[model samples]
Target: MTPESARALAEDYFNGGRPHPLDIGVYTFDAGYVAWPREPTPGDPTVLPDTVGGACIVIDRHTGEVSVRPLLPPELVAELWPDPTPR
Candidate 1:
């Protein structure tokens, strides 16, 4: 899938049907996309306790399959893409 579409899917998967204060941000990667929650405004300092230890959402490039993985650096998550073991 294209990066734009992948990003949209990830955003929806991350935020859709959920009541969340923080917005979801997606990072593109060769393997797929990494999605994580972030403060809506930078340096807002609003405590998002729920975001602590939140899993990063990974979307497959080819299949658009979404998976939840432990929170990690985007590069590291991309490098370890397509992890077979479910979170």
Candidate 2:
């Protein structure tokens, strides 16, 4: 997703207006997809979505193309989330 679109989705769904990356949990950039945390921390007292998981924002870091929805599947998530080590 373009950074703006991802930021908007994060703002609308995750709360706190425009959120910093830390407001979510973990994130990864690979093959143009940004795996934004579906479970954003309740920084204040805003209601959160019932689904406790994550979503993928496909961002073309180079061209600025962006998209949301159709989050990454379980198998792909396994591939994305586990190996990064959060440096």
Candidate 3:
């Protein structure tokens, strides 16, 4: 899938039933996309309690399937797409 499509899927997954007011940010990689909740105001000291330790949303480029993984660096998460670690 294209980056745009992958980002859309990730955003949908990230925002679905999310209790935080933060917006979702997406990064594209060769394998697919990584999405996570981001602070609406960068450098703001206030933290959205619900966003803490939220899972990273991964969207497969080929299958377009969404998976939840522990919060990790976006690049590392992308490199480990289809991570073997049990969810």
> Of the candidates numbered 1 and 3, which has the greater lDDT value?
1
Work out the TM-score per prediction. 0.72, 0.36, 0.71
**Maximum-TM-score candidate:** 1
For model 3 the local lDDT of residue 53 reads 71
- Per-candidate local distance difference test: 0.75, 0.48, 0.74
- Greater lDDT among 1 and 2 belongs to 1
lDDT of 3 at 46: 69
Name the regions of candidate 1 deviating beyond 4 angstroms: 18-21, 40-48, 84-87
Candidate 1 per-residue lDDT over residues 1-87, each given as its tens digit: 888897677677667777763566788888788888774553556655534576888888888888888888877788777764534
Candidate 1, residue 11: lDDT: 71
Better of 2 and 3 by TM-score: 3
Residue-wise C-alpha lDDT for candidate 2, range 1-87, written one tens digit per residue: 554655665454545544453343224355444535555446776776656554554444565454553355534543544344322
Candidate 3 residue-wise lDDT at 71: 81
